[model samples]
Target: MNDKMKLKQFFPMLAFASLALAGCGGSVSKTGIELSNLDQKAKPGDNFYQYACGGWIKAHPLTGEYSTYGNFEVLIENNNKQLRDLIEAMAKGQHEAGTLEQKIGDLYNIAMDSVKQNKEGYAPIQADLEAIAAIQDRKEIIAQMAKLGSKGLPGYFGFYIDADIKNSSMNLLQIGQGGLSLGEKEYYLDNDSATVHVRESFKAYMEKMFTLCGSTPEEAKRKMEAVMGIETRIAVPSYSAVQQRDPEANYHKMTYEELKKDYSGIDWDVFFSTMGIQGLKEVSVGQPEPIHEVEKILAETPVEDQKAFMEWKLINSSAPYLSDELRACSFDFYGRVMSGKQQDRPRWKKAVATVEGVLGEGLGEKYVEKYFPAAAKERMVKLVKNLQDALAERIKVQDWMSDETKKVALDKLASFYVKVGYPDKWRDYSGLEIKDDSYWANIVRSNEFDLAYVIDKKLNKPVDRDEWYMTPQTVNAYYNPTTNEICFPAGILQPPFFDMEADDAYNYGAIGVVIGHEMTHGFDDQGRQFDKNGNLTDWWAPGDAERFEARAKVMEDFFSNIEVLPGLKGNGALTLGENLADHGGLMVSYTAFQNAMKEKPLQTEDGFTPEQRFFLAYANLWAGNIRDEEIRVRTKSDPHSLGRWRVDGALPHIDAWYEAFGITEKDSMFVPKEKRVTIW
Candidate 1:
């Protein structure tokens, strides 16, 4: 639900690249069955999504956050493995002290270069921290925080939400829920044995951060304990990064003046200066609950502990966003607190993501020009249209859903604005810079710049067509009904999805279905509540809507019955709409392929028929392996079904599965025609 997710994490440009590897589904040597006919069609290499995401599945076997298999996350971990290979090659390279040759070994030549000296390193900060006992005035605390904290205030202790209660009489404050952790809330609060172990590990990490901050072993331990408590207070808030950014859910506006009267200890003037030095003078605090609670807690805290809390806040905020020295020092604390790892992030992991995030689309544009090619993109457009056509046709034929519902559904489909490649307007980063000494400053400036962009846009006319989300280098996609748009970034444009050189069967089976998937989002259960204009409202007749919901209920129960992990309960209500979309996406994508083959006088090109390949391509998209813990996490949080269920669930409704595989009741995926679930 964070802005990043809702923005654009799709694979339009990348999906087209999938076109290049099109129709390459060659036959698989089936178990126990000998293939005497070499001329017979083959099952594609990317058969079951369960298998394709095998490595990722195995790694993220446990689930925690949003439901389904962490499809997007699985890709990220796989990408990290690729990045690790680059790191390995660089580490093992034998070369001269300085040369472009050695540099080519990895992303940066000095990535692991030892510093020539530790001039002005930890000793000064250590001395200053000892002086903290002398300072008690709130203004002095602010000054010390600015000098030491990376974020000034907001950046401290993972995150510091401004529950500024300056204007409200009721005194409710909005607390930001999440910051950096394993992304699971229980990582901090859960008292279960595993959670306890993680907490102890976190405490150990806190000591590591203290060491980085120039504290001695004793001081580091003491400092970390202090820091951990402050962070826990912040963490206990009722929102996550996801919830805070969800405009659909969290749009309650309030005033600063109201916030001040409610939240304690924070002088309204000083607090406003920290958040928006210029803007707050004019506008009141929006929501003030978190600050109100924070104030109450601070009032009850013993005088001896106040300094400790304030100093820790200074360290937390100042550590991450300042200079690399501070960043490194800060991570010493943050890394251990969140992950239990005490080591610094490998330079490549942090910098490459930043570099690629910034320059990905520009570089991707070139990469596509050279390797992915425009032909692939153009061909994908045709397939996208074909999938759209297929959906439109399905709407026309849906028996359970009345014609009234179909009309509205078709309009939503027809209105889908496909955003492929990068945004028309790239984010303006001219104000941001990479300074040699002030990494923290640069980060703060960048954040401020980005925050300004979002805030400024709120006052202006909504830029509906602009891209406010992911760069093309990311490997995911999403459907945003609020904007009535489906975005496909350039990041996912390569591999597995489509291959221009591959046959029509593979291409259609892959990216064509993907296009269908995004298309289905427009008409998903929740999406159906919104009109074509992207405003949420009931657009369908009550009778027709009820029928549609009844059909979707079957899908909901199906997913509800399937346990993604052993004991964790699946949230069928949360995931119902997405399940519906997946089922429909499969149907729409399959039908498109069926139409594509109609004129070809098609025969089985692989050992498996085209229809079989079609479904395989689908399962392949979701293929993965997972850790049991990861599965538990995903089931508790993720909205989509597990990879296995996604494949098995969708197959029964696909009539083509029966025709192509000669599937009968004996086959697990087969459902009698009477029992088949269908709705447009």
Candidate 2:
């Protein structure tokens, strides 16, 4: 692949499992499968995704507020309702000062106070805007960028503290390319008609925002051009999403002195002081080329042009918290133009979402207490263990991997730490101050508080393994390579993903596969680079590593050829790890499900065999209706394949699935025996 086209998608915090399900379950039939979701006319051998999801897709269409709707959205809607109740109840009640509920309630009140918000239009961020306008020199511009960076706003670049890839025991500061109003570099550079249209829309959006900031049309045009020039320059040095996947390649450790000397334009001392860091040592530069590009831009770009870009960045970052007009302008571009949503989500939903983002763990504490049960956690524990056992057995008998590599893989499996339902310790939010006077101010403070918290936790402190990346209320699961752990939040441990009431087949196919998927990640392309302790290491023998890469290459070619939309092909290399996990998860979970069946025999239920029901449950979890625009975007950006491909692409590789459904070479879904790609 061309280096320019090899840009890897960066997950700033942690990587989540690729194969996950959505939502609470609906009415169960005798067969456990929601028969209403099945299209009886479609043959399983020809197109399993359609066979399994056709009816469900027909029943559910994309609403104005959504670009895509599926099991995940249904679950989110249910969870959002629950969150809404909690927020509303808190807003309605009286609580003491400095309490979690008080903060929640107060923020809710401020957000919903449209009259007050309209009266104080743009006042909350007036100080920040004025500060940006005051920047006349290069030093001031650098200082302001650092100030904005601390408040979680992108300036010339972005930074975060993550477990050091090499050490896996200490945290290090990682910096990369940023400052794009458009989310991705491809939006600024791609010559496709859709991409060109997006660039134009972004320019129009910037003009509207500049006008709202009290600029004349001429001034707005100049500012927009300056901003685009700087962003395009920054985008020039950005690595493709594919390049970011190789963690070892991205990790470049350097001292503060070396960095300042090497990239000489910016005053490192002023920037660090503004960020409240007294001393700095080593920092990991993620994409060094981008940083060099930034240095070059800083040296060559005029102070006025730099200020123009900075001003736009500040306004754009604060737009959501500004007046309704500004917020609507933002929505019109990012929402309608980008994702194809025709309308804004309800005000209450937006408010609830803001609160969740700011104080997720606090909200999650309440969520798990009321919703997640002890029995569900207990069941999940057993399910995970079964999957682990199945994977261990498979590793022991692998023909390609040497005995030495197998032993290490088994050790890594044994060392896996599992977190279910919720975290053992909830984050302390007492330091965060929330006031009802201004919603935007409270959000800025929240961002500052979060920034300080992250710095305090990582700078001189040991790595906190107990720290959870996601809140309990998030309906997602992840495997943290650095921590060597898999986390299943309480929000995801619900009916459709995992349910105590559901049959063994359903649970195994849903959450069971999820568990296996996470576990399989430890041995996937990127995860395999890390040892049991989560440090990036080559644990595999030389021959074994080459063989694994060869197999992975097969997967890359297979998915790259798949056309997701007209003239849009899936980026196989970009999605290789995820596709591998899906395949591995299904294989391991099927084995685990069979083992469970042996313990408690399964019979044909509701006219479907046990194996058939299991496969159907897997397919049903991903059934969704999505817009063409969204499909086109995901085909380029999303790491996971589309839901339809997740089913149709993965099932044919599984021997048991074919046997259970009586599929053969004559079927459309069949692949020649020699062509199937299977890597665990």
Candidate 3:
């Protein structure tokens, strides 16, 4: 499974300014969910998103370095400042060898050591460059790819250790279609104005990298074309990002002997041996159709062209860690052209991000000790339970689902494993050696160490159900179908999403809904295919499954029909799972809110009823100012809908939302009862 559902497109940072609360104590609304951010001119029924978030959007415009900015960014910016203080303090303090602090601090110090990095320049990566240049035959190329893959530079395809979908108890080798430089197959295939322009820029980018690698001008041009040609061929075989969403379509188990017989361009024995992977009798190919094409591409392409392609891949992946010129060239295409960011993020921020990536859990242990309190975790537990109960109630009463399916659904819900704040066991970093000598070396070494641990140690072993894909410092949550678990990181347990002292109404609408969102992921269009044991077996009755699919199709069509830009429409089929979670979460959270108020009534404050406040809180969290370029990219790539559509798209489907906002048939966002899609 993938990591947690990311709310924002951009990476999170520290809050720029402390949110102005109404009171001196934590009881104050630090989340900024008041009506001040609303645009009174807009009718709530006609355009609820504009009504709820127009003022905030007007106040905050996109910054030079940010593609999108919103509540998540604000929280991250605040978090980054806290982390920056901790990092800076640790960097200055003395620590023992192999300590988390020492490793963290040394990594930070090396990254900031521009002089050392500049003096060494590309000299640090000379050995890797030489290895790629020395490639002569297919065997050497295959071995080199393995070497690079182990070092975190993926050369040909992707491989990872995941719990076998059919048997969740075992960790198995998963080989999937990868090796493309662009984000998706569409980038290479689509002939839209934007796609064509990006393709041309990417070709130029490859040429620039080849030239920088000391290739003659003509040689660079020819090599770049060859690399692009190879990539395009590979792209032709790969599934679109949307098609990859279907788990059943992708899952294919095979013995090693069977796989070799099916596609025999590269010797599996030699390749696996080179990768240092042993004792593997079988593997699950996520997409065998694309992999079969790899055999054809290898046979048709010359060894020289393949070498050029591999060389480009090596240089392209390592460019960011190299000298200023290479890094700048890399950023020019990926950062500026892709995301429309005119400048680089602050060096300290970048350094902090790098440290977090390598030593996240280690740093996360420190983050929780300093930030997350016992009370917050305790409160979250109750909130999660409330949402679970609400969802269970909805499932029992679902008119379309039969009693047989309901029983299985409840069983799955009962089996749900919830992890809050941090993992029960922390990952040991004592085995990963980090030094202050070289930044690039530390990164490469860390990648190798991680690969070895996963390939040599974790693979072929029993699955660790308690293991988390995200760090405690990550501002996100996830539902893993394979583990039948939902995780809430400490990073998301703050203002906007959750505030310890906020009234129950706001809490239910914000963090409570988020909790439900993740919980609903278990039964989302894709997630529901996996049973309680996290096995890919159908537990639903045939008729009930068909009914659910029919209802799901309505929501899919609704999202697909939405025009994000001229000639650009949202891919409903691609984002179906997320949309399902959104709709289901909203319904269940609203139920949980009603259940909460039955215990004790809350008074209306600032002229908003508790119900209205709940809806407002939910909408305000999605207040975002995004760049047009980012909009174009995310429309084609991201599975989650945009902030505007997250509100406008999902809200129209909820009957309670229309009643709370006094919506009518005349309203632009109005959806009649028959047209509204509700799977839950």
Candidate 4:
């Protein structure tokens, strides 16, 4: 969906840190840092990330299956094994029809049946393709786009229902620019060699897909050109990723009548009726320029060309579920070309991921019951409280903010909605049916089932603040500004993030920083716009807002200068929010760790002082290897800095880090106090 509310997470998708100290060829301990994991040969003053994580990096090199491999993947692999056992057990048992077990079991069995999938080939989507070919007029074409979009295909534009940005209580219909096969507009428009290579690869993949669907070579070439032309025209006016970050800039709410009159290329009444939405009075057009461009393309394009574009959308979206050949073709461009993943993941992994995606909360309910410990939740509550108290203290003492703003900041801090482990209530999958059918057909039905919920229950309803956006099995944490909440799912509760046996320093540096990072997101450039109640209203004093930006600007310029690759540099403005969260997380969590030590003092363990272990533990959370292609892709799309930079680029600005390592101005990584950012 185009207008999903932003949930600022610690990492991009599948992004998380691990602090498990086991399996590093060191003495096994229930607590403390992993001494063998550190590259003692490297100097901390010059490269702390390398010094702390070098040994781990050398031990765990990137494999063909991953573009990047680190502590997060280690945790993911462990979780997947547990999930596989659970799902496979269900698949092997006999359950009553319409039961949750039956649905999940049948879905997994069908996905794993490669013989059936290969036999079906593209037969499942042939009907949809025929419908596109049968279209005779503009209205028919628009109607077809709506039909495909309902099944999660990219149409000329994207539409969804979400909490209104300005009014956070009620759900509103939102539209934004989409339809580009290459997600980033830069890939289509950039003149760089890397971009051009990817562009060509995407084009080749498109032609191959057309040919696989029984098109002649000549016909496939013509269709590929038609689809590319349509998509390129749409990409021309689409918002850049950075531009889309500004909530106020992206949001343009208009009356239903105004929308129909201004963008009259499509029939609004028909579109809404087709989408099963009624009584729609207002809509938010996020990035209207691209929608206007799409409108022009739709109205002017030839009927045959439009049909080819629609067919391509269906083919591209359905390839993963269709056949092995189609799946490999899809992965060749997206996986091998874009991310440089040398090999495809195992089929069981793909099937497991599909089951999780469609019925996540269902799987999560069982996952929490089996894998998540009750004691972990109890401890997390206390850790969260300690971090909250620390943040409140920092806000109260901030010299850059006035008393008027300080009061509000502390109020926001106190009002934080903390969710640990899992949600109090889980989603019901009673209406979903899993039958013996084609995998692609089942996928479409699952998507429709989800869309029905959004249309039937969520539209025109009050936002459910208690609902969890992520599953219990997800190895991640997030801060949703609209809900003013911080969530730590069950998957991230285990080591090296939260070790019940580890001392305060290890836990504080790992999960403690994560908890504080989500808390600090409330005051980041975007999150700061939302008030205590989660409405997008500016509550800062005049001078305080200016001072916050001025301080943040230093962070922007600091990261912008660091070269992640030979010619590529970090996007300071794009990563400003995450950078601020990282900086603030360290400050708040360190204060909490110190407070923790005051009550129960800790002695040095594993030949490192408590302070040294704290930083080392934090660095270990980011230890792993990454491919250069992934580096380029992430630089263009990901908001979080590279893992190495998360440690290296971030620690330089942290004053406590200097004290922990005894670094002075003479150190290569030292920054003058005048230039360092002090914003929390």
Considering every candidate listed, which one attains the maximal lDDT? 4
Clashes of each: 106, 9, 9, 2
Better of 3 and 4 by lDDT: 4
Per-prediction TM-score to the true structure, in the order listed:
0.70, 0.97, 0.95, 0.96
Which of 2 and 3 is ahead in TM-score? 2
Residue-wise lDDT of candidate 3 within 174-207, one digit each (tens)? 7888767885888999998888988999999989
Give the higher-TM-score candidate: 3 or 4: 4
| Candidate 4 residue lDDT tens string, 586-653 | 88999999999999998877778888888887888888899989989888877788899889998988
RMSD of each: 8.3, 3.0, 4.1, 2.8
The per-residue C-alpha lDDT of model 1 at residue 530 equals: 61
Q: Relative to the unseen true structure, what is the Cα RMSD of model 1? A: 8.3
Q: Which residue pairs in candidate 3 have backbone atoms (N, alpha carbon, C) closer than 3 angstroms, thus clashing?
A: 13-76, 13-77, 14-76, 14-77, 14-78, 14-79, 14-80, 15-77, 15-78
Q: Against the true structure, candidate 3 has what lDDT?
A: 0.80
618: Cα error in model 4, Å: 1.2
CA-lDDT, candidates in order: 0.51, 0.81, 0.80, 0.84
The C-alpha stretches of model 2 lying farther than 4 A from their native spots are: 1-23
